[model samples]
Target: MVFILDTVMCIVTTMPQTKVPLSKRERTARRLTLCLMTEEKQRRPRPSVPYGPTAKTVAEGVQKMRKRRQLTIYELSALLKKAGRPITPSAIAKIERGERRVDVDDLMALTTALGVSPAALLLPLKDSPHQSIEITGAGEVPADVAWEWASNERSLPLSSGDASEAELGYQLHSLPPGRRYLRSRPVGRAVEALRRDVDRVVEISQRSQSRHPSEFADRLAAARLSLGRLEAELARMEAEREEFDRSSREELERLRQEAARLVEEQSRGGGDDGAGVD
Candidate 1:
């Protein structure tokens, strides 16, 4: 979006709007101008997203800190500036809306600016299969302790290919009372197998389609149309899922607040002591 805006601004600068109407001859002379404007409109870019646990992103860290610290957009923008970004509050707003994909560098800047560990903000949800990590306990454990645990012989079995994740869990549990870490390897193997399977399937499908076009010829264009509809449906379902999650969270928070209010009222009333004789 920024790039598109900049490009549009540049075009505007070069050809400012005119209150004067163009002559038929003049309009005909500048048909290329119309083509350029059409192209510009067609190429508008989507806004950018900040990587990590954003308020609207599917995670907790950034949202939790943003609420706990009670920071406003202006304040966040100031922090971003200090981190050398110098973007406006609106820019941050766009990022929060998940319009663009923020790369690794922006994530580092965001962590430094927000006074958080890069890991905390950037870490995916614990249950998200994208991340192959397990974290537990308190403040960032120092590198020396982690290194010591890594060097210890108790960090046994040396390879991640072992059959059981339960065994991995047990091994970690046995790691003599300090922080333990291991990256899972099975998921990588699974992903590679899936990729190979997909490639073979796609190759086979294409060959089959090419060899037997007559069978599906009536449905070929219709199949493309159906696929597009499915893609649109998937997008709609993704949006609905997000909306449902938001509604559920809002209801949960409202219930918590109501329960807290009731607790306060009960505490103030003091069961039977503060009430009239009953």
Candidate 2:
């Protein structure tokens, strides 16, 4: 059946159309070829959708970075090729013109060629620190906020209020351990800074009490109130950290066990196959 179809296709395609009267077999072959071509066209994947805002940002960044580095489109293409992810200069041009969508592989190659982070390409240029960026699903956010979120410095807050540790943990859970540490570092430093401020205020209050007993009452009361609020915040942060740690350990163990199970199953399957062969 396949050979017959191939022969029909070859005759129908290679034979030139002529004004001569057609034979019955020739007409049948032509119909079969037309049907097969239509089916093949239907089976082919559709072209990608138009580039979105994020893709436009990457395109702009690629062009901007390339120019800043004193590279032409061809030079940038050469660099990408050297990095083992070659994009033709014409395709790079289309990408810069927002006529081509930059996929993940292209984005990585562009980042390497442009000597910038993927976040740098993904985020729009910071014309002003206060400029608002329209991130899909997240709506509009400040440029600095967008950069921070993209860089994994902090999680993007989708809600109206401040993002809680649970949200942060959720974001960090999928990240590797090194990235999780980096992402959580800024918050940890802020907590430590607040603790130091509370400590300093308490030490000052104690010294004041020793020197001027009368003034110490109001000062001590204010310090106590402030300290109480800060202490509550500190405790909440501590609890959240512990919770994040516990969840991370559990996830890691689960992944490890899943991997081991797969390995064991593959080994057993291999042994059975070998026995069957013998």
Candidate 3:
């Protein structure tokens, strides 16, 4: 009996132990640990698409302007919604981070919301005037230069020589007549003033010639010199005007011919359609 009892005790000692049920506190602690692990995984950064130089410029510009205006992302989004083009705060955040591309519609909406011009967002002209910006197919150019070109303040520096005939035609066609001649107004006024001065000097010289020949000779010489300068300036202005007129006429003629050709083609097409119907 003693041997059997000892054998039973040895078997019980060697037997595998069963798992114990966890207490409430221990189970709760385990659940919390798993939740924390999942939260950490969720917070990990994901890969983002790289943005282009232009997109980066726009993003930076938007962020800079927003900060300058002391506007929150939510406020800007609200403003955009009020402007009839709604963009959410999340989308605005993505745009400012360059994680999202700003399309034409988005650009217009952002410009309106931010109270800035499209050019302001497109270029870093205000934030970093001296910085170089890369234009696709155009290579790198100064920010201010790009802004000026974008704003139509000046043409691009693509050509070393004077603007080509095609460029002149484009400008003449695209811009209003008043805007085209706006810059020349000052030149015109200067020319008129010079002409008046020349006329006054000539009149004075002529009147003084009868009274005092010596005085008249000196005055006449000065008047002649002034007249020569005025004549030269007028000649230059006349040449420029003639060139502009010639270019304008040529462009208009070309457009007329193009329109006539298009009309003839349409007429032929119509005739063919009529024959088919018959």
Candidate 4:
């Protein structure tokens, strides 16, 4: 009885531990769960505005103008798409939320879509010194006109008269220290492209007049409207170009005068030195 008991104990102690192999499905599920847990631990929330406060201000401005214009995100997106620079509703939402930074092209597109100046979206409107005021003497100012000089003032001041208040404000915002505006080259290029479109429309109008007089009557009206817009844009570009040229010329003249003065001084000093040596 003792030997049998010892043999049974030995058998129990020597017995191998049972092991179960995991099936393919179990292994996959285990891996997926581990991956999910790791991902959850690693994930972090993104900031609302990656570019900081300036970007947030711009975002707010975009939202403000959009709302003021009573435009839906989808409608704004569609307008931008029609302008050949397509943006999605989701992307506009991100911009308004300050989650995304706006690029130059998008900024221009937004300005076009929103029917507001780029300055409207860029500058802080609350701090502007200039405000719209109605003039008493205007015979009949259109509802669309935003600014009119007071009737008591005979003429607009030279400094402010050349450009609209919006343009002046944009120029001021972009001056010297920081230069927070689009380049003149891009503006010029856009104007040139638009001018080409205007030319094409003119050609169509001429052709229509000969081919179909009835069509010409309709097309002529549309052509005039297009011409008016094109001419306005062209005038703006010309004004900017003229200002640039004028400044450059003035600077050059100043430098030339400075060089002449230096030359005169040097000559005078050399003559004095020669007399002393003599």
Name the top lDDT candidate. 2
Per residue, candidate 1 scores C-alpha lDDT tens digits across 1-278 of: 87567655555554425677888666544554654676678787755544433333323555555556788768877888887877677766656556545557766776677777665554433321122332232223333232223334223232346547644675567644433332233333333334434443454456577765654463454455555555565677688899999999999999999999999988878966756665
TM-score of each: 0.31, 0.49, 0.47, 0.36
Better of 1 and 3 by lDDT: 3
Clashes of each: 2, 0, 0, 0
Task: Name the regions of candidate 2 deviating beyond 4 angstroms.
Answer: 1-48, 127-129, 160-162, 174-187, 191-278
**Model 3's TM-score against the true structure:** 0.47
Shift of residue 139 alpha carbon in model 3, Å:
1.8
Q: What is the lDDT of candidate 3?
A: 0.72
Q: Residue-wise lDDT of candidate 4 within 173-256, one digit each (tens)?
A: 544433323323445435444544454456556555567675556556655665666677778879989999999999999999
Between candidates 3 and 4, name the one with more favorable TM-score: 3
Question: What TM-score quantifies how close candidate 4 is to the native fold?
Answer: 0.36
After superposition, candidate 3 runs with Cα above 4 Å error = 1-50, 126-131, 159-163, 166-170, 181-278
Stretches of model 1 off by over 4 angstroms after superposition: 1-64, 83-85, 124-160, 163-278
Q: Against the true structure, what is every candidate's RMSD?
A: 27.9, 22.4, 21.2, 21.0
**lDDT by residue (tens digit), candidate 2, 103-139:** 8988998998888899888888662333888776787
When 2 and 4 are scored with lDDT, the better candidate is: 2
lDDT of 1: 0.54
**Deviation from native of the Cα of residue 246 in model 1, angstroms:** 67
Q: Ranking by lDDT, best first?
A: 2, 3, 4, 1
- Give Cα distance to truth, residue 184, candidate 4, Å: 19
